[model samples]
Target chain A: MIDVGGTEGGVRLRAPRHRVARRAVLWWSCQAASRVVVLLAAVGFGAWWSPFPNRALVIALIVLGVLGIGYVTVMPWWRYRVHRWETTESAVYTAAGWLSREWRVAPMSRIQTVDTARGPLQRALGLSSVTVTTASAAGPLTIDGLERDVAADLAERLTRTTQATPGDAT
Target chain B: MNEFPPEEATAAPTPPPGPFEDWQRLDPKAVVASTALVVAPMFPIVAIMAVSDDGSTRTLTTAGVLLGVVVLTLVGSWLRWYFTRFRVTAERFELREGNISRSFRSIPRERVRSVDLTAPVVHRLLGISVVKIGTGQKAGSEGELKLDAISTARAEELRRLLLRPRAGTTPESATPPVADSAEETGTELARMRPTWYLYSTLTASLLLFTWAAVGSALSTLSDVFRALWAADTATDWLSDTASSVWTHAPLWAVVVAAVVTVLVGGLLGALAFSVEMWWGFRLTREGDATLRVRRGLLTTRAVSLERRRLRGVELAEPMLLRLAGGSRLTAVATGLEHGETSGRSDNKALLPPAPRGVAGRIGALVLERPGTLEDGAPLRAHPRVALRRRLSRVLLPALLLASGLAVAAHQSEVVPWWSWLVPLGTAPPAVVLAWDAYRNLGHGHRDEYLVTRYGTGVKRTVLLQREGIIGWRISQSPLQRLAGLLTVSATTAAGNGYYSVRDAEAEQGLSFAESCVPGLLSPFLEKNSEFTSESVDSLDGTSHERAKKRTDHP
Candidate 1:
């Protein structure tokens, strides 16, 4: 029985303080490793196809290697810095992204389902991601990089809230 | 409405042999009408065989085979029509059909969302219409039920009965009450205006005409080239005369002639298309709390929408249409999914292109409210940094194109040196468009409703009911962070499900979302004394005054 339209209209709200687990950096690095492999494969194909001299191929590979190494080393830290999430009684707020920061709020009543998932890498790192599905065209709101137990707790809370609130599902 | 006899109504009760007893068949003329489909394809095949060089024996065999297929198809259609039977009981509508594989479908009285009636030219001539019942379900064929041909009077009566609000909310207890208390008379909401139709036709027809003219001219040019290459001795005097005239005509005159021809053809096409599509467009509110729209000339249509399912109204104004002060209104109602194959035109359009003010007035009438969401307090504009962000976004593309052209010119002569200046030439228009987009960004709220306006090329102002908004999404990019801006999206079940307000100050967007739906975001909002005191103090006074005025006026 929360009042949804009776609050003061101009206060700037602060994002939650709970940062993603430190193991998230390891998880991100694992993903970056796959991307690095793809990039190297692409560079190798370019070297084979191009009519340019071997010197040009060598220079291209060297530059690509440096960029790839930089990305693998730095992107994880940037992603960890921006990732933040919190669950309230009526809604879940998540702020994450590296170059483009996205802050999304999904209300409990609108949530159709809540799922907690643990990938092979995430399982090894004791991390999980929680996804809340709604009818919104923005697609599902996912909060990645959470401790396994925390993700489970969030999923349970979301499901309970969705059931308690009496509203149309879609 | 009282066309049904009393004995027929009381013949079957609950827990009987079946829910339906007085089953009825479609109009007999339906078989004849459907036979056209079977006969249409055979005509060309039979003609080709008749004109073939093959002997009379082969031609006779082909004709005999075609005749057999046609006869079989006609018999199948007749049998199918005979087997299809429908019955309207007090609690549900039962449809029994199929000869080889008997199929039975029943739609509960409470689950029906709409009952639409359509009559194509042939059906209209036979004085029969098709009735389709829509249920808000995703099940394949169960979601919609169609009776191919039924008497127009019966269709109207069934529409009224099926769409009538049930006595209670639960489906189990739903039973036909005594006749509806309200009279059958409906209040006319809107009809197509001649001027609006003209503008609508002109907007689309002009483009069509241009394409047609270009296609014809290209074909003619190709024909002349082909004739010249062949150098046939059979070249007629008419062609010789035409070639002489073509050579004598100035290039400017030819261009002018083509342009004139395109414009005239476009105008004519627009007029014809508009007249055909919206010949008798009419929207009315039937007494049973259903909004019914009847339109189309050759193929008449009648679609009814229960008021309970309507989410809101969307006013769309495309760039050219906006310039002419025209807007289109569409109803965002559930169960009226804009599917690819189903020609459910009436389910979407509430009003065709019309004066913006007229569309607004009709929107208000459809919602049954004196003041709509747009009538609330003036919309709040985003921070000035938003304008800067948009301008940079526009400039970035232009800069990239200029650099790309420069690189291309340096590599090869394929690109002209002057092509690098193209970005500069486009800069002014891009900047102007960005400014317009920024100016259009706004969000506001009224009692139980939320209003959002945005878009540069196709401006849209939506007035959505607050209850329909099931969730909210707030996002910010890196560039947006520098500008202290965030985008807020209100998620609903209708239309695109998410309507966004772009480039608002982080604090402003959060506060706007919180106030629009109070407790949903407030619990998570960390209220700092410094920011709250500076921001909330000013906004509080204006919002309080507006809320008070709304209450008093309402």
Candidate 2:
């Protein structure tokens, strides 16, 4: 973990990077599964005992499996490759995007609060996600993929730091 | 003690036992009082339905009465309990309530911008007042420090602390000592035109009553016509009235008198409601800092607001009010939404209740100018930005409309001429809007303060000092990148509202904002990099010390 506060009453603490990764997987998995199920059902009904038959079914199944594998396997790899975190004395910046990349930097003083959340997959992986909220309505900035212990420690530290430096920028 | 000046000696006198340790719970009676307000409005329908003789309607009315009684009683009791629950510690004021998913809020004293004390007749008699501490957030955010059922003395003391100018924060020249002469002068409440004010405000109630009366009369007229169409006995009664008015002199006089009496009665009903609404309207300046407002008959409310809390001031001149140059001024305070001067308790107030001249005075006090509406503090922008804005506004719309017309003309066989007219119609407004936008836009700086103002219809200005700005962002679109234009926005803890300046200002504006709002953009604007967690070590103690030096004011 980076010492964000340094020596000048700066805020230090953020959810670990891995917890953010697991959440990204879970969020996309739900989306992918729904799309896959719909596609499979449509294929099954549309091809049901057609005259062209066995060879086509085999091809279709192969294609579906490959697609599912690609979605589950390839996407998480891309996210893990892209996901990054950096902390400054004043804020935490996390960037995640495949092609048209984006970044979110939330200043420690500006952060009103930090919320830690864990999904079933994340719990299994011992990971958690953290969301940093500011007074603005743009919504909270989220970092996924943190080890559970790391998540809790980060939350505690951030909470203490924020309370200590109350009325600062964040 | 050795011969130091009084100011120097009093520099650190214990900080006033901190943010008050004792906080009163909201009056238990308030639940009953507020619940009555919510329930009372619905009761009139029940009374009307119950008295009506229609058989099915009467049965429904009875059932409604039974249902309303149960719901009202249970909810009212629960609400009373919920609001009355609170605790105040030395550091914060905490409120815990809500049936499901209990909500709790802790408001610190430093965050409090202003403290308001209000009381109804009953609360006054009970020697308790409801205290509202405005946290400077916009409507619908929970940061109020409310202490209900408190004595007036405690309320006053708390208000003084909250209203007191903080050392090293408020400019030394901003607030001078209150003049003793002015403070001693007090206006008698009786001197205010309570009756005339009530009569004028009754206009609104009268308008509502007239709406109902006119609708009822029209329906009754339609019913009479329907009865005549069916040749019914009710129709025969109407015919008799017509015949009497036409033939018999005395009967005609009676008919005319009765018609006049009904009209007068409807008008009188309106007048009564209006009078009831604005019953005891009174306005007075309590202290040098606050304007005290007291009004209402059943539930009298007293409002004490600091002039500094006022955001935007408006002067409304209704045609009738305008005839006598009798303009009503309304003020919009930062956190407050309702401006019901008359404790009419009806929540739907279009404008704030202020004195006829108070809006101008309050406006001057808040903005340092009267009549001329000012927005946030001034910011800096390049002159070339106006040209870009004009181009975007005038050219974009013209291009889009012309293309759309060409596409329509090509696709559709009919209305070829109309399609070509699209650009012609859109051109004028686009030009005007762009011109207005150009004229209204400006940015400036007064040392620590970065002010930005823009808008044609309702000119909005946001004043953000380096200390007040929590964060900021500067973003450029593909078109904007090519055009050397950037949109920069700064967010403040004062509320979720952020001020923005677009098109005209780019790098300079953003750099200024970035300079003011520390830690907005950082070591993270990396090019062609992914999550490079190189652990930002550049922001050291020295940087923070520098930031503090830049931000701190004496």
Candidate 3:
């Protein structure tokens, strides 16, 4: 049975049953850093080759570069803290976000498909993401940063649970 | 795939073994309908060309091309009418067509949801209608079947047969099945009044269409000049006017002229379109359930929304229409979106712009609810911080932009004074709009409906059926958290699929979502739980870990 915490007492959703694989922090950091590194390199190269340097623009870019570095390091770490997933007897629940957080619950009956995906980077990190889709076009419920095997198991279990139900919930 | 030549292939009338035994070809008038489709657009151009002084080489060339098109169309229509065959068996509805690249589609009869019929003026003249069978298949339009130019009687028969309430599926269920026959014409719930067209004129679509027409006319004139090999002269003349006009006249003059022209032109355009679209508009309920909306002058549409698929209804009042006390009603129904074949959402629309009182009464009738909709439960207002957030989100940007433009205008040689005036003038309205939007922010549960009202520009109040909601999502940004605000989105299969009560107090939002669909969110929710997080230092762990330690606030 589920219970609601009243506002005066403080309302909240309990952390989902499980967190993503820990190295997901490292994987996501590398992922975020990769793009920022390219951008930083491009700006550095542009400044070095220019005959006339704009001091103001260069200083602004440096400030931005430092902030970008802070973001690349801090964001993944925060995302890891927030992203959690749980599958119950009747529903698949997930919470994910960094600066902003989103908590989504898709009933097992409403689920249309369950898939597991691992990109080359994720594969190298031994990580995979499980995606659960419902009839609504809003989007799929994804639990990212899981061990490949765990993702596969989750997908299998979801498929079985969904198949147990008869009609397309919609 | 248009090849349905079943009657043509009836050389052997022997009893067949499968459902394919009686492959029915399209009605004969379908060929004429197809041919007319090809000829209608070009006929006017050709007529004008034929009357032109001394048929030139270009005229002759155009005429020849059109004649060839007509010949090809006639041949194509005959093949299409001959090859397309559809048969409905007890188990499934199957359609087989195409000659060169053949394809077949079979839809299980159980998957069928609603059958809609449309009769354009041309089809109506020929006593035929277009039949679209909606199966509500999530994998796009594969489950939808469009049969062009079927007899009106057959179209009606198909609708009734396909959408008839199934055995044991009664209308009293939480989500009812389709309606059974109550009356021949059904009981009329609402009829269009002649004066409703006045509100249509208040809509921006009138001006939008008028401006679009002017834009196309200008482009066509330029294209003609290019075709006549007078492009250079036209370009020179255009440049000369462009250079001479703006500098000589105040920018406000041009704006006023353009506005006036669109207003007057749009009035006429709106009146014409309103009549064409909403003339003879009627909403009827058959038996206890299904709602049938019949409307249009040039193109009559009969869209059926089975009660089970009726998730909710939205009453949208655009700024102008709202000022005039008028609102448009649209359905939040499933399996009615036929966006693939026709870009327009013919089925979702329930009523054109009408008086707010009329729209509300009709909405209640359609939903089978007793009291007035929004008046049911007083929607909870957002925390005062929400007003601050909206002001910063909308009015702050406008203020900043106005200041930026003012500085740019003063500093730059090319920038005009009017550049700043535009943003500065818009600032007041932006503030007003922001306040209006804040006031409109609220959600409440009214009996079986979850009502949400938002948007200032359109200001829509949606009375979505609580049972229709498939899921709920609670989203928050860091800024939102700092402001103690969050958004709750109710995800459904109907309408836009998801509608949000944006910028509500975080606790209220969660509690609201929890109460609407009890037990769905409780296991995930914790009492005295703050959403803040603590750092976990075991990132290199071999097994899964719960990242944050839940802290209880004393």
Candidate 4:
């Protein structure tokens, strides 16, 4: 319900609703754990084989482990708080990224296609993501972490909008 | 879809025409020219061997083998020329080629965008030219069709026929009647100036500095001389003279001498290259709403660009070129591939290196409007925080290096105290560059075009059409967010399609985007004032206002 071009000025944008399932934290943590394990294994092997010194290896392992644990516990929540997406009659707005937040707006008339995808873990969690592709060089806009049914409904609505609007010239 | 009438269908439809009936072969001279080009590289090797006094049976046998290769290549090229053939029907243009595994392609007549004609010195003498047809597609050779070594007259005829607008099919066909009258004989748009060409040659020769530096190294120089002279006596004499000069002169003097020699040689080479490439450059507007550029001294190239496909113009001014008050203009258009055959990305360049004023005039003529791009309005500069960001970026690396060197000097006797001076010596120039870059950053819009200017080394001022932009991307780093700044990129289909205005205030960037494309971004921006009110009230008011505006506009 944002004003399009009012002298009253300034439209308040609607942010996306519905956070991803809480289990998403566990899924991301497991991915982070595998990387930490490889780093620890490398440092342990260096300590056993290198004749120069092992003190640095021990210090490195401790520092890395602390950082990894912090990242695993904290990053997903921060990402979920920042990521947002919304689709209106004329345009789709997507905001994403952790360190450098990026906001993109692609008009419905420019959209080439819309698709919904579900990975194995997402299927287990009953969550899905939708991708909106347009004839732009900035590439496609993807919104992840929605209920499976909601993702399907959004994708269908986007498809209908694109079909009704013509003229996607590249 | 329409079906045939029932009575006509019962009567039986006429059999369709065969695809290959009208296929025609290219001129036979093309086979000879291609074979000669392939064989040209062997001449130097053969000459070296001949001068080395190798008269043994092995030498004879090698010559015999080379002769066999030449014969085989000649036969192969002839076969290829015989196999390649093309046909032009009313609905489509078809090309078929290949000896073992063949490829057949048929492109619809409506999809053909432009046909370009070119001729090298040899081809020009032989009265033959190469033709390429573009279909306005984005990816690789699938978008292009080439026909090499046709009669020049036929190429011109084909170009005219292929580019003629189909009646009532495309809106572009509805050009004004004035253009129709001008179509009988094309009007000259722009021509190269010799003085500007000289400036372009000197500025473009900057790459030669790297080659000169590498060539001055003694080991590489000796290797080159040894290879060229071949005989041991010649190599010894050359090395002895070189070493004697090196011994007599101080090290710095020798370096200076080498640098001077390299610079002179490079300048001469660049001068010759520019003279050959841009000798007779000219741009003309044809009646079919196409721009045709003809240039090159020895190898002539004529490129045809459809006017409708051109998105805008880019003025690129390299630091040295800008100092000389010169800039080059490149067309921002789709289907213009960066081809390797020409040396300077010449396919995209509409105007050669010229004075800034001349470039503006030519750009206006090409766009078919005066004062469209060069509106003379002052551009809005980014916030002062942008300057602070640039300064910090430049100074941080220097500070780190100076500190690292100081620490090393303190810890080790081998580290010299004077080495710490390196970063200090570089800081002044770095600061100047950062300030210059900040000063150059600007963005503005006029009528249908959005103009942005940026760069430190090679300043680029791009004029892009507002309607061409398909979306907007707003990005902000954590630091940028703290400073209330963001970078906005206007995404289009032409060129790389990411034109950015960096370090602008977030609200300013959002408002610019909204104004450029109207409703596309207005609905998404959250005004600071609106957030103070209840969400429902703000939303309802905005939507209703938007609807009212739409109806009023309609």
Fraction of native contacts (fnat) of each candidate: 0.40, 0.11, 0.52, 0.43
Model 3 over residues B1-554: C-alpha lDDT tens digits?
A: 33433453533433232313256777789888888888987775666556552646988887789899989988888887767788766567788777777778888766777788888878999999999888776555675788886788767756765565554332223112223234356889888898998987777665576668777977876665565453576588988997688778899997898788767777887788778888898998876657888888989988887888888899989999999999988888767663333446557878878899888988988888875565575898888898888788876677788788888989997888678777667777778988999999888888888889999988999988888777778899888989988899988776677888898887788888878777677767766544432322333232232221121111
Estimate the lDDT of model 1: 0.73
DockQ of each: 0.35, 0.11, 0.49, 0.41
**In candidate 3, which residue pairs clash?**
B3-B83, B3-B84, B4-B82, B4-B83, B4-B84, B4-B85, B5-B82, B5-B83, B5-B84
Scored by DockQ, the top model is: 3
lDDT of 3: 0.76
How do the candidates rank by lDDT, highest first?
3, 4, 1, 2
Please, what are the lDDT tens digits per residue for candidate 4 over residues B30-54? 8877777767756765776677745
Q: Enumerate the chain B TM-scores of all models.
A: 0.77, 0.53, 0.82, 0.83
Off by over 4 Å in 2: A1-85, A91-112, A115-130, A134-166, B1-364, B367-379, B382-417, B517-554
Docking class of 4: acceptable
TM-score of each: 0.77, 0.54, 0.86, 0.85
Tally clashes: model 4. Answer: 1
Give the lDDT of residue A13 in candidate 1. 49
Task: State in Å the error of residue B401, model 1.
Answer: 3.2
Candidate 1 stretches with Cα past 4 Å from truth are A1-10, A16-28, A51-64, A115-129, A135-139, A145-157, B1-111, B127-132, B135-154, B168-183, B205-249, B338-346, B371-376, B403-415, B528-554
What is the DockQ score, from 0 to 1, of model 1?
0.35
